[model samples]
Target chain A: MFGEFNLIDKYFSARQAQRKDVHLTLGDDCAIVKAPDNVRIAISTDTLVAGTHFLPEANPAWVAHKALASNLSDLAAMGATPAWVSMALTLPHIDEAWLEPFCHAFFELANYYNIQLIGGDTTKGPLSITLTVQGFVPQDKVLLRNQAKVGDWVYVTGELGDSKAGLDVILAPEKRQEPFAAELEQRHYLSTPRILAGQALLNLASAAIDISDGLISDLGHILHQSQVGVSLDVNCLPMSKELRQFAPSIQVAQQYALTSGEEYELCFTVPAQNKGTLDSALAHCGTKVTCIGQIRPQGVFELLNNGQKLDWALSGYDHFKEVK
Target chain B: MFGEFNLIDKYFSARQAQRKDVHLTLGDDCAIVKAPDNVRIAISTDTLVAGTHFLPEANPAWVAHKALASNLSDLAAMGATPAWVSMALTLPHIDEAWLEPFCHAFFELANYYNIQLIGGDTTKGPLSITLTVQGFVPQDKVLLRNQAKVGDWVYVTGELGDSKAGLDVILAPEKRQEPFAAELEQRHYLSTPRILAGQALLNLASAAIDISDGLISDLGHILHQSQVGVSLDVNCLPMSKELRQFAPSIQVAQQYALTSGEEYELCFTVPAQNKGTLDSALAHCGTKVTCIGQIRPQGVFELLNNGQKLDWALSGYDHFKEVK
Candidate 1:
């Protein structure tokens, strides 16, 4: 036990500098965090099981980064500034080599966002990680999915489908690697940029959600919550060149673009009147914001290809569905 | 997925009314909570895996209560007020019967403490629960385990060793039902009352920790952190009459008393000068505060028996150690 503690102290403890808001940190049974006045705290939690979320032999650094980034994306979706996070990590054994890179990458992302590692539990079990992240939002300014209204234009940040293309390469390394396979793999490992674009869109977007379960499925959440529907332009779906190159067919590329999971970009709705301002904010943030659809009064989702409606075989990734 | 969502709405949603500090409750990616002025939030998290933490056949309600209570005890140790908690539950299947009672007991405790269920993630996996709890403490009055000084009186709330005694009954139901095993079995199901008494002692106690990994091991943490030692009166170790009757011998009961885990009582250090005030506060809270021994400058943990120090065979429960 002391060996484990010392290992954690030697490698992970000082990797990230303590933020001013953290009154007390890791060495205690719990941690103390101070929240400034007039700031609402947004909190979200996510758990990743080894076999379910990532390959057992996947790079530990990327695993750590992706796990933490997934939860941070939730904070970003809420238009909140990342503040602190508590990680509950359970592992079958402690590998110093794995711990070193994992902790380094974990803290690198944490420090980049100025988020403090407040508290958590480390125990022995199947490799699993549960992270509860806290973020701060100015009073009356937090974003939600239920706020979308009719005539609001739907927009997304960054390209989608690239992550899924990357994951394909990761899960099946034996397959012949395409010219863009390496690039796709890199996207799979690194998470989408979040805090900056989210902060810039906070005042402009009416409703927003991070695209985790692909664009279509995740967008369905916003539509359901807001009691609205959407008419999406299939041709407007964002796709990286790497995804297009690796996709077996145009249909497959479109399917992956619409339904691939682990893409942490934000899909949001904004009134037509605020489009100019939204565009300006995106430009200032230096992030791509593509208008792909519009919320409608009728509660039905439709996809238009060129001038005719088309049916896509797959809607989005569902945990219960058979994996492709 | 919708079924699980409905179950959550039915069972967990209404309980939000019990918490006054919650600005926004469930149904969002994250929950928002407000901290009172002059109070710093104390946070802790714990993950309990099925088979590791409890028997697979254990009642769901008890499992839920124990999971939340264990984390809540961390707040109690710091003399903080329980404010909110988020629970992540992963299970192989969704059984309505299991969820109903589990949520019932969970909210019962949450409502009693006014700790709201803010936000969490639910997914399909091995039966496991991760609970992150938040508590509030006056900025200057948070109790820590590194403040104990030489000569401070060592005190503990409630009786110890019952949970371990209860485990004995769980391991052998037939023996558990024999003669005096009924009460021990009952103790296994219901947990120790959290020490609300600690709130008043926050300013009086030098250092504190919750007794989870038995008295000997858990108190050692305080001693190690504070750079002090302790002399415990073995004869003064508290055990329920039921535990004594069920044990094979007094020595066995003593061993269990010193080494059992899951006793969620606060173990604290207070200056001898503050003994009277501490006694009064415990009495007012209707909880027992037993002065078991005193803190020493530096030495090995000593067990005083018949006015002479005696060697004890078993140390406290070490998670990494093989079970006897």
Candidate 2:
């Protein structure tokens, strides 16, 4: 008859922190959190499933990291500072070995971001994780996709397509059996560093979105929401040297960079006046911020190669599409 | 191919009232919610599985209602006003018939509480639902179980054991099939009303918690967190007449009232001076508030019958326990 009390005390009770904003935490019906006076809260949610989102044998630590990081990236896109989170975990059974590393990784990231695990629910089912995160931004400071005005310069943080290259190595390990492929495999397993740069660009950027569904597809979200279009130079798409070397061809590499997902980088639009400020911020943060394209009044997305228009073959990874 | 945009627009988007606190809602990477100065946010999450929490054939509307209502009850217990919610839904397949009713019931309750569904994630899997609800309360006004003190009077809203009685009717439909047994069965499918009564009691009450894992078990949480003890009157335990009529004996009815989970009523403690104010608030709310026990100096919880202590069972529903 081990009831909710014993289960909570045994597994989750002591792991919480004592904070001024946390009036109540684990062992109660719900947890309470205090918000700062001048900050608005940003929230996002994501769910990951075994077999669908990750391999069954993937490290539980990585699984925990990726799940929380993915949701946090959404907050970053909105130029919000990480604050708190709640997790709902469903598992086939409780395995102590798996729970230890999973909790360690989860708490490590949470502590790094100063985010508290305020509340959660646990149940028995196939392995799945759902995370909802709360973040804070000054009033009216949130970056929104609909705010991208025509002539705003589009920029992306960090190199793209590395995750896609990593995925290729994982899906076809035998095809890339060369010794140098291990680095590619690591990229797929560990996601990109979160774009904390959005915090600095909050006042400067007109619109922003996280790169989770490839450059072309996620950029489409900003375009559709802002009721505008874009014309990107294909050569301008940033890629890691490691990604270029592992890719099958230059065209294939370009296509993967345009359509790969899980990069966790920020794609934002800044006014021309703020270009120097953005460059200075990026240099101070030691992260690359590339100006890839600009917003246009037209309603169509276009790609140009060597100053000539090229027909794009793929849009991005669509969830309902037949897997390639 | 279905991507994130159409998935959200077609299935998740809805017209919600423009909340003064919400700067932005769905269709963005994250939702922007304003938190006023001097207000603390309370957050909680819960997940429901098809076969474990409800029958597979359960009404979709009730399933959706119970899922969100149960989480909202946690907010009510903390005396927090509902503000935002996000859902994670996994389904074997999409059925329009099921989705329409489910969404209707879900949105109906959300509207009633003025809580908006700001964001969510949907995927294919076994039928499961995870909901995270956000609530706001004035700074220093949030109720917590740890604030209860010795000499405080313990109280509860609404009767207990009706849900368990309803479950009995559902589990054994053929035993002495009474007229309106179908109505009794409906109770199992329906959710308990949240006791918004806590909002009025926040100033008067010393501490509070929602009774989801029965009165005795849930009170233990408050006791443990507050470092206090309780002496409950077994004769004062409230139960519906229908529950007593259906139970095998008075002791069984008492046990059910003390140990059944899913009541969703609030259990709270208040200073002796505020008893009159408590009566007025409950009266104005049109709900019954009963004083069944009192807080005591640190010790084990006890049950008294006619001024004499009685040995009682301490057990309730544990989600991870194996069914007999």
Candidate 3:
């Protein structure tokens, strides 16, 4: 806290939003905000720790973007329109080089979503950032994981697994020379949170979740919550061209798609009746959509490729029990 | 995240408030809450790192209480009625022995305040707790530091410095033999958030702040924000009998009171005409109120003891420049 205000004024407070709803912003003990009437606010908190969520030596801008994007993704998964965020940032020490672009990328994303930076608590500690985001969701239109019924078609917005492939290059520099390395890295660092797709899925999709912990694992959340199972086809899983070219094989690229722990895509399930409307609803979002599976009756999860049963399997990097 | 849901269901979801405003609580991608019509929300975030904010060896219950109490203090400073909280808890590893008491104490205080635990994101990392709290306040009744004007009388609710003396016993066990040692530690570990006092002062106080970084340091915030200054008498500052008996001298006891970083007392400014109403407003809170300072003309801060204009100062543990 020794130069806390100066640091915030120099970097953070410099990025003010034209958000008129915020009555009090930074520099005060607390911030005051007004919520629009007739809407419920969806809220989520995410913490990214040095060496746990990202490498301490990683680019500050990427760290800031990833931290904010993940939280935005959480709100998106809940079909909420992003609005305001409060950050609790702990730093080992102040560094101008680090703070400049960190604030820049963070505000850049905030401005895109029209979200206001309402409150900030910066303290001295090992590097970590915890962000709490609140967004407005129409009172009657909330997407939840427990609503998918049997026979619902599982869908995902945008390609998956490219970021995992992208992360490999950052983790092992030799992968930098791999085919389409830059695009893969872009997938990892600038992963897009599917806010538009999530908002669009609110009425059409029965259940939704962000596929950060891999699709199968995250889709399992839907299965568990809804008390149903799914018959998923690996061939139907979406993949980026770069991920396919950079990965050793189509199978390996699909493997990456199945288990990469940082895709911000929305994995949702829609009934057959809404399938036609779903495509039209998402057409303007400019993000691809693919049907990956069908919800099955209770206790029946099957993996298929090209309508043929396969012994293929992929588990999360951790939490193997969740994979099944 | 292996057992994240189970942990939350066992500890957090068990402590739900009967608050009907909450649409959803823990156990989802995001929690949802609705704001009552015509009220703006007050928001704040506080991050407490082990060894930085609390000793790593401190009891889990104390850590939990201190962390939550400190955040409640921030919201109270803004004159907001506590409502909902979201926590991002990063633990080095999960231990039932540690988590049980930590969750118990956290919920005990939260339930006492009738705040809902809306959103939680638990992760694996070094121990740190970041809490974001939101409360409702009438739109026009916000008490901001910048609103204090010249001639306002400065008042603080309850005693200070005893917590600092209490911390001394915890830091060095030999001090445990000191008179009123148990009460001192209780002051440090179980400090109360002055919610009722803040709610009562909404219309009566010109400006306000929660005193955690000592009186002079926090009061300087008012001076800086209001563009005015104050003449405060240290001898008039309130002190507990326990702190007075424990300190080697009256001066030492006053020093402890002036610099303790853990007191949750509400330090506020009231216009001269509102003084009588202030006492009546805070009467039911069961806390002491003392007038120790008078606001001065712009940029003229003076510290006094008795009738003597003696130059005496105490800096924050860090941030020397913040102390006048």
DockQ values for all predictions? 0.67, 0.73, 0.84
In model 3, the runs with Cα more than 4 Å from the true position are A316-324, B316-324
Model 3 per-residue lDDT at A114: 92
TM-scores of all predicted structures = 0.94, 0.92, 0.96
Q: Per-residue error at B209 for model 3, in Å?
A: 0.3
TM-score, candidate 3, chain B alone: 0.96
Real contacts recovered, all predictions = 0.60, 0.84, 0.83
Q: How high a TM-score does candidate 1 get?
A: 0.94
- Residues A287-318, candidate 2: write the lDDT tens digits: 68888888787455667887788786786533
After superposing candidate 1 on the true structure, give the runs of residues whose Cα lies further than 4 Å from its correct spot. A1-4, A173-176, A316-324, B1-4, B193-195, B316-324
Who wins the DockQ comparison? 3
What lDDT does candidate 3 reach at residue B91? 92
Residue pairs whose backbone atoms clash in candidate 1: none
Best by TM-score: 3
Candidate 2, superposed: residue stretches over 4 Å from native = A1-20, A173-176, A317-324, B1-4, B173-177, B307-309, B314-324
Q: Which order, best to worst by DockQ?
A: 3, 2, 1
Q: How many pairs collide in each candidate, listed in order?
A: 0, 0, 1
- Candidate 2 lDDT over residue span B1-324, tens digit each: 134455667656854655777777778888888776767778899999887788877889989988988898898888888888899888777777888888888888888888888888887777889999988888768788889888899998888777777777777767428654565566555655554686887788989888777787688777777888888887888777777777889888888888877878888999888887788776677768888899888764667888998776557422201111
DockQ, prediction 3: 0.84
